[model samples]
Target chain A: MKQPIGIFDSGVGGLTVYKAIKRAFPAENIIYFGDTARVPYGPKSENTIIEYSIQNARFLLQKDIKILVVACNTSSAVALQELEKLTDIPIIGVIKPGSKLATDSTHNNHIGVIGTEGTIRSEAYNKAIKSILPEAEIFSCACPLFVPLVEEGWLNHPVSRIVAEEYLNFFKDKEIDTLVLGCTHYPLLKSLIDEIMEHKVKLIDSADAIALHLKTLLPVESSTEPVMDRFYVSDNEAKFSQIAEYILGVQPTPIKRVRLYESWFE
Target chain B: MKQPIGIFDSGVGGLTVYKAIKRAFPAENIIYFGDTARVPYGPKSENTIIEYSIQNARFLLQKDIKILVVACNTSSAVALQELEKLTDIPIIGVIKPGSKLATDSTHNNHIGVIGTEGTIRSEAYNKAIKSILPEAEIFSCACPLFVPLVEEGWLNHPVSRIVAEEYLNFFKDKEIDTLVLGCTHYPLLKSLIDEIMEHKVKLIDSADAIALHLKTLLPVESSTEPVMDRFYVSDNEAKFSQIAEYILGVQPTPIKRVRLYESWFE
Candidate 1:
């Protein structure tokens, strides 16, 4: 039995990571769980995030998964270390791959990072980039509105452009050649962000980078079997299904509503 | 011993409700809990909101309260029925008082309601308005971005104006003489919303309405005592403290961080 790869995020944003993995390995069975009930982990405390991350990992682990992907930047920044101790399976977080890519893309060693407040506060991207290029000047800003805007499906809306400009204009004077789309929901705003930055900055999308990183660590077993990815969320499935369609441009696999642990009421 | 009034919201937006209660009965001791960890219950499903509302009420009930205020519009819209069954204490929700005030303020029986997706979708305000004025014309719009924009501290920013126009423009032709600030957080945007409606719409803030309704039901026990309100949150205190100060225009009482229930890990 080929154990499937497990991916989890606070919400649907992780579907971007799922899409990349699917493209990279077409036949691999996959399980995706979105903690939609307690989402936007961006503004939550470190301890709370760690606890939620552990619960999410435990939920996915029960399915006998081969590998785990921490698709959420906030979780990757703060919970990745704790998650490593939780399980022995190869755990991949978006931070490291994203950092390496940002460093590789920046010719001037000046890079800007934008994400949720929790992720930016964690300084995971800052440290990761500095570790590779000690002299790298990393400018980080917390774009809290970006997630809601994307979730609101205002991807290319004029207001999104205004919000992107409000958040990304900080990079203009910094002369950063590369900017890391530090949150999973951020890539959906790539075009707007690109327009704001005048297409001068190379946007580091961790999805493809994570896919590349995962391929080396776990070689895909050549399989002719068709892909059947499982989707689950802690809260409403309708919103998730609708957003998933908007993001992936196709109706997602039937999504199951789940409780991370025993129902609190029960 | 005077039993304190227990008030709870999904997050700090409920502070507006707390302010109203405080002003109405300066001597009444009050307990306010912001479920910051699992906040913005606006986008969550009905079942999840009900479960969370129950947990919040349970947290407040342990304090031996005289009355309970479901300060969050989403909770009041969906969870008030369940909350009443949980406790016999006189329970007050922002919806009915707000509806009553909106109905009274409108001469033409035309009213508009703006709130989070969950609250607007529940149509509590619409139902409440119609119950009083069957001939009333109601217009409701889910202003999901309003909460994030407020939390981002863009209360009167140009971006807020643009976003307000985007959401409220739907009601332009509806000719609503009164608009219910359906979500608790909305009062923060009252000025901007007023401008978008060209000040023609009378904004009905549920906080003041809820205060008046509470007065008739639970008469204030006249006593001269300094107010020492207890504030608690399920997650980080820093963000809540800062935002509370911004909303209330005074340093909030020292806030305690707590888990609504037994820790899932423990």
Candidate 2:
């Protein structure tokens, strides 16, 4: 049996990353977890985020997966190191790949990053981008409202447009050639964001970056059958599936409810 | 020393209730618990909410509180019955008092209630209003964006005004004479909500109603000294205190960090 790759996020926002990964590796089995009961990890404290991230990784690790993916940007920013230290399995996060994409896409060294408060506060993107393009200047904004707006599915709504304009207007005078969609949920607001930026700035979606990164690291398994990807959420399976359908364009099957605090090994 | 009154919510939104209770019983000590780490319980399932509510109640009960108050309307709606079963101390929730206030103020018995998805979905306000005024007509809308907007401190922002109009416009043709601010965080948007309703509808703030309800139920203690109110939050003490100060008009001192799942009694 092929070992399933384990992917987890604070909530369904990570489905974007899941979609990208699936497109890249259609034959590999994937197990996905969303901590919907305690989501929106964006504005939460670092310790709390770290604790939740560890719990999520433990849950995924119990499946005997070959690889682990931290799909949530907040968790990627704050808890990636702790998660890396917890297990011997190869762990990948969204930040470095997206940062690499930003550095490659930008003509000028100047780039803009927008994500949840937690991600921006951690300065993960700023540091990652600066490491690659040593002379790069990163202008990052914590667009806390963006996640909620995206969750509300107001993607093309007038209010979303107004909010996007208000947020993206920060980059107007920055002379940035590329902007990174630092959070997974942000890809849904791409069209609106592009319109707001007047299509001048290249937007780097972390989902695409992480998927491409996985392609280079993992061998492609040859299989003709459709993949049976398992899904789990701490709470609200229906809402998760609904949002998953909206994001992935296919109804996710075999989704189960899980209690992460309950030790899976025992 | 008198036994302190306990109030708990999923997050800082309940500070509105805490402020009201403090104003009503200045001499009585109050203990508030905000489950900030796993907040925005509005979108979670009923079972998860009940589980979280029980955990919160257990934490507060360990402190020997004389009375328990469920400050969150979502909790008040779905978890109150479970919480009432968990404790013998007198329990007060925001629902019944606000329902009574709305029933009393409506001239046409047409009322509109707006709150989180969980609160609006529970139909607690509908049932409560119907029990009192059998002929009451209730129109409820789940204004999920309002809480985030309020938390972002965009109370009077143009985007807030536009969003409010979209939500409150549901009651336009319903001829609702009264509107109930079903969630505790809603009072901060009082002026914006009022304007969206064209100042024609009477808005029932649960904070004031809950305070009045507590007044009739409890005897006033005789004390000239300032009452000491202890605050406990599951996470992000800084954000909680910052928001608390904004809602209460006074900085909350001696706010402690707590782990609700760690079993305080054990």
- Distance (Å) between predicted and true CA of A252, model 2? 0.9
> Pairs clashing in candidate 1?
none
Q: What lDDT does candidate 2 reach at residue B47? A: 85
- Cα deviation in Å at residue A13, candidate 1? 1.0
Candidate 1 per-residue lDDT, tens place, A1-266, comes to: 56899999999999999999988888789999998999999999999999889888988888899999999999999999999998899999999999998888889999999999999999999999999999999999999999999888888888888888878777778999999999999989888888778888899998988998898887767787666789988898988988899778997887888853232221
Candidate 2 positional error at B175, Å: 1.3
Which residue ranges in model 2 land beyond 4 Å of their true spot? Answer: A224-226, A260-266, B224-226, B260-266
lDDT of each: 0.89, 0.89
For every candidate structure, what is the RMSD over all alpha carbons to the true structure, in angstroms? Answer: 2.3, 2.9
TM-score, first chain, each model: 0.96, 0.96
Q: Estimate, for each residue in B143-223, the C-alpha lDDT of model 1 and write its tens digit.
A: 999999988889988889999998988997897899999888899999888888888989999899999999898877778
Shift in Å, residue B238, candidate 2: 0.9
The CAPRI category of model 2 is acceptable
